[model samples]
Target: MDRSRTALIWRYAGRGLLLTPLLFLLVFFFYPLGSILQFSLAPDGKLDFAAFQQIFSRPYYRETLWFTTWQAALSTLLTLGLAFPAAHVFAKYQFPGKSLLLALATIPFVLPTVVVATAFIALLGEDSALNGLLMKVFKLEEPPLHLERSLKIILLAHIFYNYAVALRIISSFWSNQSQRIQEAAQMLGASRWMVFYRITLPLLLPAVTAAAALVFMFCFTSFGVVRILGGLKYATLEVEIHYQSLSLFDLPTAGALSVIQLMTTLVMMIVYTNLQRQMTQPLNLQSSRQVARKPRRWAEKGWLALNLIVMSLLIFAPILALIERSFTLGDGGFTTRYYEQLQENPHRSIRAVAPVAAIQNSLEYAFFVTIFSVLLGTLAAYLLSQKTRFSRWLDPVFMLPLAASAVTLGFGFIITLDEPPLNLRSSYWIVPIAHTLVAMPLVVRSVLPSLRAIKPSIGEAAAVLGASRWQRWRRIELPLITRSIAVGATFAFTVSMGEFGASSFVARPNQPTIPIVIFRFLGQPGLANYGQALAMSVILMAVCAAGFVLIERLNRAVIGEF
Candidate 1:
């Protein structure tokens, strides 16, 4: 009878804990999303398909759809091609400065999209040193390579920016894999290539598929890279949404486009999740005692060296260009003018505000996003860990924001809340709200794994020793999951600071964020503007680096290792 009573009490307590996250999702996520869908379906205050029909009827829109689809597909393929070998190398080999190289590879992923776009321009722009050098070497009167405003440039930028996603996912999975299977195949008279194809590739399929799906989705919704490099010719759903809403003031059409984009993203995510379930297997490499061996043949070492050198150049060249350009002067001498410009107010700029204001705005939004997302995500994770029916359904729902494009969601927010008791536009709250939507999913993913790692009996034990529910949570669960929460918060902070798509739509004109400011400067002409842009980019990089270091230190203190 006592055991039954205890079980019943615990069940109710778990249910109560679940309610908070449920309420949060219902209010912030589901309701806003539902409002947009409803508004898109009935833009004229009656049931109609006018918006969608208009979009499908137009040839331009159809062309955009095709362009976005193929470019994203090509980008994913290229990224996979580059990332797979790099991931394999990192997983199988140990070398000097491996950690630094890995961190450098990840830098592109966290950088602001505008910074990346500008870096590409600085590297290959009309008056760039690369263009000048090519002209000089070839004795040509004109710039020989005109990659600007081309589909190929857009695709390359996407691959460069998102390849890290594939590398990280594949490398993590590969590191936790045992070499015994491959060794056994080799001993059975299998060639090295055959062994990899027959054994290693099959086991790595899950991570590969997951990474591809994610990369595809990211490329599909790409806006800044497409807009900056592809020019007006290449319009993805993201770019179309922005142009339709802001430039053309076609809210209904934008809403319709957003819905279509959301559906496409959702389908991809569902396919990936289902595939992941089927691909699951016991990963015992973590406990396996055998150490990895280095390649013995000279040819193998030469091949490995060539691969590493090529990957390093591909990943590092653009970054090196940016850093070098940041210091270069017109007279071919090094200068600190760009770095100094960051400290001065440049009010004559289009935005008419000090650069520091943008930095502060980004930092503030990131802080709020980190705090709220971590708190709410931790609660949701705890509820999910308890294994309730409602919790199971809720788990996927929290991930909807991640599956939806930021541009689409921002458009949804614009149309749905143009007026009403929940009107949010034309307010300071828009940017942070949009950021929260994006960061929440990262928070949940990070927290859920840690929450699941803790055994339930620990909480029960504390409760049995006359501890109150709050005391049990404070002393046990919180301590166990604190590192995960910090990691989630760090991710949220970095994402919020660097995010551009939603910020462009929602940020107030006077209160533009760092990325918005960088874009503004890059669009203008002149050495001063270019210098300022580079300075701002450096500042943004410093902020991200500092935040990551703090996260690393906190993780070590709380969880002992990442």
Candidate 2:
């Protein structure tokens, strides 16, 4: 009876580990989700399908849904098409600056969507110098390239964002395939085509599927790029949700769309999650270094040189344009006028805010999110280490925020947390709270892998040696997981700095995020305003790149998944 009672106490204690994350989910995630879902279904006291009826009845909703899916599908295809070649280049070739190139490819994915849009405009917009030069060269009256405010730009931006994810996933899978099989097949007179189709492709399918699913999910929920680039002509469900809730004040429609977006995202995420599990299954293959060789043949040399030029131009040209435009005056001479104007209240009529304040706000919010995310994520990771059925089920739940659209969460803040006991609309804490929802998932995923790696027998051995639980954690577990936690912190910091969709709904009027401020600057007319937008974008890009590099180095000491 005593032993059973003791076991019960320990069980409850172990279950207590989940309380923090569970409460966070219940209050912040579930409550807000329930509020939106309830608004859609009930609206009043009694249950009704009026929102659904309105949705199905309206051509607007149908069109938005169609465009969202259509664009997302196209984005996924383009990203994959771009990624396979890049991944192949990295996997098969040993070259100088390969790691540097790979890292640069990843930079776009980590950047705030607004920054990317700004860069694209600076490089490809009708008024851009590049376009102007091209027009002069071609003797065209109008700017020949009309890439801005169109689906083409949107597709390109989506590819930029997802390129790294596809490359890493596919390359990792690619590297693990044994070269012996290919060699053996070649010895048997099998063609490279036959070997690839009959062997290599079959092996690569799992990782490809996982990467594609995630890319689709990201493209499907895309907001910043679409909103900034697509403008009034295109509307994804995310943009539509923002429009209905904030613009039109149609809560019912917004609520319904949020639910739909959430459901679709959840399904894709679940699929990716399952496929990822399959990707990690043991593969009997050689390291990439063994298979990789320097460019020898003319074709190989040409391929390498072509990839170098294409990737460099793709990643660096836009950024260079942004920098150039930020400096160039209306008369075309370089000046610090745009950068200098950041200190003053440039536009009084339009919600005037100092550029410095916006930077401070972004940094402070990022710091807050990093601290909170690391703490909550550490606790969640601890719970995941328990290895119970509940823990297994709970693993995916932590990732729900990653799957959920930022706009949906931002809208949830307005509809639920704005009133009564949960009233946080006026509080700046709400911004960090929203950021935490997004960041926490990354934190948990980063740290959980490391936590699960630590054998419980080490803790048991420590316990038998008279080490307390806290001491064991401090000595053994903390040391092992610190790098992962650091990785999560870096991700949290970057996400907070760059987050736009959720911050859009929750950020106070005068108090705006960096992305929000850059967006505002982009909206105003004038070369200086445009230049300032570019300058601010340059600043943000620098910050994210620096933080990513530093934190990435920290994670290299520990074997943890991003």
Candidate 3:
């Protein structure tokens, strides 16, 4: 009778714990989205489709939509093409510093888009060192490089941002898959090309498609790159939303664009999730050491070296340029003026604070966000990992937060959470809440694999030995997945540290984050402002890179789905 009562209590407790994540989403995610819909479709309690009509009827919005789509498609193709060969090399070749290379490749994916823009500016802008050197060398009066504020730079930045995402996903999947099928086909009188086309291509298709969809999703909703690199001429839907809402104060148009962006990203995410599910199909797997080999021939070695050089140039060159430019003025002597100027409010601006304060504000928000995301994400992970009917449908719903753009989510928060009980527009807590919505999905992704890997029989055995549900989780699961939790926590912290889009809308004027400060510095006139922006970006980059390295270390012991 006691055992039966205890079982009933534990079951109810489990169900209650599951409801926490659902409640969180309902209050935060769905409520904000609903507020945007309500505000856009029916202002003053009347139905209207004027915003939607304007988006379709106007040439400007129409062109923006087309540009957004085509650019994303182009970026997707270019990223996949660039990363595929690298993925193949990483998967099949056991090279020195392979793990370090993989970790370095992934750092860009975590970096703020603002930092990426600054990196490119340092490398290719008209007044950049490269163009300056070229002008001096040829005794020319004008700078040479014209890539900045062009379509070419936009594409290049997109590829740089997403290369690691594609490489990691495809290579990780490729490494685990068995190569025996291709070997068998080759031994049965088929040529290498024939075997690759018939057997290898089909096996890799799902992972490739999955990577493409995710890359397209990112490029489609790109904000910082377009806003910074493309300048005033090019505008994606995300940038348009920001313009309409903040610059123009046109909420209807902004809300309409938000809905469109949300719906489009939803489709892409759904496709990605489905493909990812297909990618997990059981296969004849092989260990990486068993399949990977050292490059023995000169041709193979040359190809490997060539790919490595390209990867290094593409990923590391701009960053190195940014760091060098930060310390040196256009006149060529190294100086610490920029770093020193970070503490000065030269203009004594009323609306903005010093860059040093922004750093402190960012660290505080990151601390709170790490706690919120780990708690909420762990609950969501446990709920979704359970082998229950609810888990299947809820899985996609939880990912909806990830699909929604940060700008849209911030806009939603402004409109929805302005009431008496939930008023947060002026509160500092609101920033962390907005950041948590973005970071939680990552935490969930990082922690879910650890939970799913646990066998049910082990839990059953624990229960049979008179262990309560809480006791079993605390004693067995907690210790087992500690490293994964740490990895998730690190991701949440880093993501909050560099978040820009949502912070732009939600952060208080005097309490800015690091990215917000960088944006402010860039907007101001003078070389000092630009130098300060670069200095702050380098600082933020170092923090995020350090976090990424820690995550890699933690994740090595327990690999996560991320």
Q: Going through the candidates in order, what is the number of backbone clashes in each? A: 0, 0, 0
Q: Model 1: residues >4 Å from true position, as ranges? A: 1-18, 132-142, 175-188, 283-291, 343-347, 552-562
| Residue-by-residue lDDT tens digits, candidate 1, 1-562 | 9978997898798778667767766766677677667767887688889888877898988888888898889999999999998888778766667667777677788777777777777677775668878888999999877888887677778877998889988887787788788778888899999988888898888899988998998899898888777777778999998998899998778878888888889988997788666545676565212333465788767866877887777777767667777888355579998777766775566667877788888888888888877777777777777677877887788888888887877776776656777777888877887888888777778778777777878878888888877788788878877778888888889889988898888888999999888888877888888778877877787677676777656655453222
Compared with the true structure, all predictions reach lDDT values of 0.79, 0.87, 0.90
RMSD to the true structure for each prediction, in A, is 3.5, 2.5, 2.1
Candidate 1: lDDT of 448? 85
List TM-scores for all candidates, in order.
Answer: 0.90, 0.95, 0.95
The list of candidate 3 runs beyond 4 A from truth reads: 1-14, 348-350, 460-469
Cα deviation of 326 in candidate 1 (Å)? 1.9
lDDT of 3 by residue, 236-350 (tens): 9999998998899898889989999999999999899899999888988889888899999998999899999999999998889889999986468999888898887766432
Better of 1 and 3 by TM-score: 3
Which run of 10 residues does model 3 get worst, by summed lDDT?
344-353
Residue 157 deviation, candidate 2, in Å? 1.1
Query: How far does residue 73 in candidate 2 sit from its true spot (Å)?
Result: 0.8
Better of 2 and 3 by lDDT: 3
Q: Is candidate 1 or candidate 2 better by lDDT?
A: 2
